[model samples]
Target: MLKIGPIFNYLQDMADKDASRMEMSIPQLMEKGYTWVLHRYHLSMIRYPKLDEALSIRTWHSPYKNLYSLRAFEMTTSFGEVLAKATTSWIIINYSTKRPMRLDRHVTSQYYKEIIPFEFDFSSLSPLERIDLEDIYPVRIRDLDINNHVNNAVYVEWAAETVPTNILQSMRPSEIDVIFKEQLTYGEKAVVQTQKEKTASNVFDHVILRESDAREITRIRTSWKNMPL
Candidate 1:
């Protein structure tokens, strides 16, 4: 029996959701001369299901080109309400050269047999207005990854915490994208500021900064839907 919390913990949830499906394993793909790297992802938790809830996930490749892979997923609870849904963009890299490559026909056929298009229009709530709040979190030793910089997951964790719980519980995240502009080394301080979009109901924009030096490290835009957007 797969327990929910441990495997579905903050960071692992994003990864395990992808690993449980798919015809070919990541390692297998690497051996076959391709590597998959996550470009961006959006996660929304609408009522985190109980521990014993029997859940099922289905993933399909919507389409792809040399630069990116468009994959979609549907997650349902045992009682059958869609718990989580997301589309991920992945890039196939040449392991030796570390450059992106065009997706192969054989690989596309293996993952997706038919193409169905779906767009939630989450962008309508993006690029929020400028209202400012200060968020400071100490960069812990554990936050440091092998690259000697703060891990990307930490940014998401901080942003999620800063978002109001009522808004988060009522709305699911329709889309989220972030760009890493700089690095935050261990023992360095980090700060975050979030603002809402004047044009949209639940759009939030955030900036992560290095508190010690006041250098911006990342920028994030998040959009939410009362129902699925």
Candidate 2:
């Protein structure tokens, strides 16, 4: 099975590592009372590789819009086959106040080295109606990132766990969209809910809400295709 965990992690890890090269790392931003938060995710999975395979990632960004920036990524194997491609939305906000802030010239100049065209269109992103599956997820220590909140990628892994086994064995996710609603912290539990429209067997709708106060954590829409043996 192609575990959906590493791709997003690699995407994020590369972001931070690359940012540090330009002196715009997370710690640097945090010192200014600001930190970047992932707001949205869009991934297109073309194929999965086996062990002993290595992949390369190429990422670029669009100009920041107010407080938001759009980034594009493509992951290719050593053979130059595109395995996955993605686009994500990020926002920098004041940590103490939790308020969105505009990107200043100093921050933007850090990583504007190379400008690459966006490989995916943003128009396809549309709101997905909430689906209520009956499962509850508890956040643990391992789920937290450096920010002490649940990492954005953890939401994708949690959603994958809720997927039915029969579907998991036979199908693979071709497309995934994750829209973050709120942040999850330790000691909180999330209510896992999902819905799949009968007319669209390949598409599944997912939502995760904090059980403590019924606050939404995230909403994900995934499209699947038959796995090749």
Candidate 3:
């Protein structure tokens, strides 16, 4: 079955392809001294495909607003059976200053589209009130992506590492919502903290912090379902 980490990579890849189609790919934006960064994601899975299962993925962007842009993705089987869907928010930042820039300042309105496959509230994710489990993972060179920072998908893996073994073995993530707060790079270590939601045993909240200064870098919430027999 597909795992959250790979699924995230697929979503990001599709988004990149769409951006390339608009002449806004990462390399293209970097040449203009700007790079798009993912801010938030809300992904729900209807089913995870088996290994070697053929799949089709589609992604499109919505109208840009102020400093942010919206993108949505859908994954399906050969017959168009919906397997997963996601909505993401992103912002373009000046590569040199590392600060967000107005979308219109760089990207023209011509690239914006009104087609939205789905909607997800991008409200701030709440902080974890308590930690039920914690673990530490050292950043490795292999974890870095093209931007030279820890890949967004690595944060999801770090958070999952803190989940209880029983839950990891018995349940599959049905939905995952994440907010990226800061960038992590090689030679750093992440402190992952996880807490099971009191109201829903199958739901978990996670926070990933930089071990050097205890700075929170990411927040995630995952809803899980029992594995099918």
For TM-score, the strongest prediction is 3
Predicted structure with the largest lDDT when compared to the true one: 3
Cα lDDT of model 1 by residue, 12-76, tens digit:
34343454355444565667666565555555555445557777666655554446566666678
Question: Lowest-lDDT window of 10 residues in candidate 2?
Answer: 119-128
lDDT of 3 by residue, 128-170 (tens): 8998999999999999987888988888888877778888888
* TM-score result, candidate 3: 0.94
State which candidate, 1 or 2, has the greater TM-score. Answer: 2
Query: Each prediction's TM-score against the native?
Result: 0.61, 0.90, 0.94
Q: How accurate locally, in lDDT, is each candidate?
A: 0.61, 0.78, 0.85
The runs of at least 3 residues in candidate 3 whose Cα sits more than 4 Å from the true structure, single-residue gaps closed, are 108-110, 113-118
TM match of model 1 to true structure: 0.61
Ranked by TM-score, the better of candidates 2 and 3 is: 3
Question: What residue pairs are clashing in model 2?
Answer: 133-193, 133-194
Q: Which 10-residue window of candidate 1 scores lowest in summed lDDT?
A: 1-10
Which parts of model 2 have CA positions greater than 4 angstroms off?
Answer: 105-108, 117-132
